[model samples]
Target: MAKAFASQGDMSEKKTSFTEIGEGLYAFTAEGDPNSGVIIGDDSVMIIEAQATPRLAQKVIDCVRSVTDKPISHVVLTHYHAVRVLGASAFGADQIIMSDKARAMVVERGQEDWDSEFQRFPRLFEGHESIPGLTWPTTTFSDSMTVYLGKRKVVIKQIGRAHTAGDSVIWVPDQQTMFTGDIVEYHSACYCGDGHYEDWGATLDAVKAYDPQSIAPGRGDALVGRDMVDAALTNTRDFVDSTYNAVKPVAARGGSLKDAWDAVRDACDPKFRDYAIYEHCLPFNVARAYDEARGIDTPRIWTAQRDLEMWEQLQG
Candidate 1:
């Protein structure tokens, strides 16, 4: 290989911020690392997107303790990605929830993803040894499920497919605050290795339809207020569109994956090169974009070996 992944070289600790978006709703963002959300209901709390390891999860627990001593009763996972769900056991929540599709994806390719991600980004898995195993959801819903943390009404719904086939967003009607898993990112690069390019825009529209007053996005800063929310949405849309559009024509003309990668870099670098994990996500993004443009409806599972093979072919 020519070089290591950008994430592999990123060893410095990210400055984490736990910002309150709604009254009791908070977004725990660590610079551009994977983020976790906290929804403090009337009594117990509900957590969204556990970190990569138990050690990382402890950080979230500490933040939760700072505000309220309420026990974490539920952990809501938006997808089955290892980075998002593997630290679930640390939460000790009675009910760990995911969409039916997400749960199925876990059973199908969870271990492979775990290995692939661990190899790609060592920093995220700070305590890999502590990860018990693949995290499984105790409960799942097909389209949408509503859970009440006392008087708080939290709606978990599969708005559309963008980040992953099983992506779900948590909507708080009272505050109009939404917890969009990787479906919506702020300044950070969207990890589209498992993405749905064609369906992404419509999914963004579904999120827009809610007109969330605040959003605890999958990554980057917590978007509070409408203007900031809209800006992030537009930024994310442009990023996703630019990436797919850049690769679509290359694939259409029977160009190789390398060719598509070059094309995407040409189009996206000037605009998004500064985004978090921009380099780390580029190759995987391009490969998936090329596959999607070539009519692959479902993303192929990524194993540790395939990650290296792809990296060597593109980045190497």
Candidate 2:
């Protein structure tokens, strides 16, 4: 059996850590758990990336209440991943926003993703029964959209495909802060089972263009300064590049999937060994990188059975 890590009970009582990235912007992280951000405006608040369930979201709500009671008027989803969006209903925001492509992905494969993720990582979805259904966005835009919170401007843009086809980032120009959903992870493993390795590099470049002073990633510690921000981006890029390159030659030579996995372990295990979820992410990342290197453009849907099949094939 896989060795169990620390459980949520060990960390649940810990106070939610919120750091001010800019004047009125904060990043809420829970001891390397999935991250959620808050952009406090003059009158209302905009929350980025809801937690996994209403119960878990209540923790975030408590944190928000500690700061301001302006009422969370907007909830923005950087993508349609279950962990990032399933708890959206808890916020009771007037508007739930996402990319137009993200909304389509929700309609197309959201249910499949929900099942796949629940099976893959059971720990994150505490109180899963409370989730009403797949999260649907009340508003969606293609490319970019800018909303004014009173006078504060918050720009949401679909920079490029990285973590998912519909990945997005929220930029607060005044704050020089960016909330990059899963596009950039700090110490946490980059879950690339459904990612686009070829397009991920360019997406990182697009995120860099904003020159964010601070960044709230999907997981791990929030990047608080310029040096930390650069390091996060660079480390994430290295992780993705290594995974892709490790599997490329094997896929190109028509080697078996096992061959690609071996190559990936040899290339990445040493460096990424201590990162969170490294073991869980490696098999899936190698599988997707192998497929993409072999010219598979779209990622295959991951069902529970398919996950086990892939794991058995690669790691058994």
Candidate 3:
């Protein structure tokens, strides 16, 4: 391989921040790493997007303890990615929720994803031994489901497919604050390895329709205020658009995958070079875009070996 995956070399711990996006709503963010959301309810708490491993999850648990002592009654997973759902056990919530599609994905490729991600980003899986196995949802919904945390009304809905086939957003009606999983990222690059580029914009539209005043994004900082929320939404849309747009034309012209990679780099580097995890996500994003443009609807499963082969082909 020409070089290691960017994240593989990023072993230094990131500074974590626990910011309150709304009353009783908090976002635990670790720089560009995946984030976790906390919703403090009258009788219990609901956690959204568990981290990569139980060890990493303990950090989110610590943050939750700081603000409330209410027992964690529920954990809502936005997607089935290993980085997002593998830490569910640490929450030990009575109810673990996910979209039906997400649960299916877990059954289909959960192990492969876990292995692939663990190899791609070692730091995120610091406590891999602690992971009992694939995280399964105790409860699932097809389109939408509403959960009342005591008096706080939280709606979990699958707006559309973007980051993955089954992406859900948690909406707090009282505060108009949404906890968007990977469907929305802040400054962090969207990891499109298993994404649907065509449907991503529509998903963003669905999120935009909600007009969330504040958002606990999948990554980056807690989005507070309409301006900040809007900015992150717009920027996330642009990131997805630019990446797919650059690669689609190349694939349409029957260009090689390498060609698509170069095209995406030329189009996205100048604009997004400073974005978090830009380098780590670029190769996979370009490969997926190329596959999508070539009429491949379902993304191919990514195994640990596939990750290395793809990396070597693009970067070596």
- Alpha-carbon lDDT, every model: 0.95, 0.89, 0.93
Over 1-316, each residue of candidate 3 has an lDDT whose tens digit, in order, gives 3688888898888999999998999999988999999999999999999899998899999999999889999999999999998888999899999999999999999999999999888999988899999999999999999999989999999999999999999999999999999888899999998999999999999999999999999989999999998999999999999999998889878898899999998999998999889988998998899999999999999999998888888874
Candidate 2's TM-score? 0.95
Separate clash counts for every candidate: 0, 0, 0
The alpha-carbon deviation from the true structure for residue 4 of candidate 3, after best TM-score superposition, in angstroms, is: 1.5
Least accurate 10 contiguous residues by lDDT in model 3: 1-10
- How does model 1 score by TM-score? 0.99
Q: What is the TM-score of each candidate against the true structure?
A: 0.99, 0.95, 0.99
RMSD of each: 0.8, 2.4, 0.8
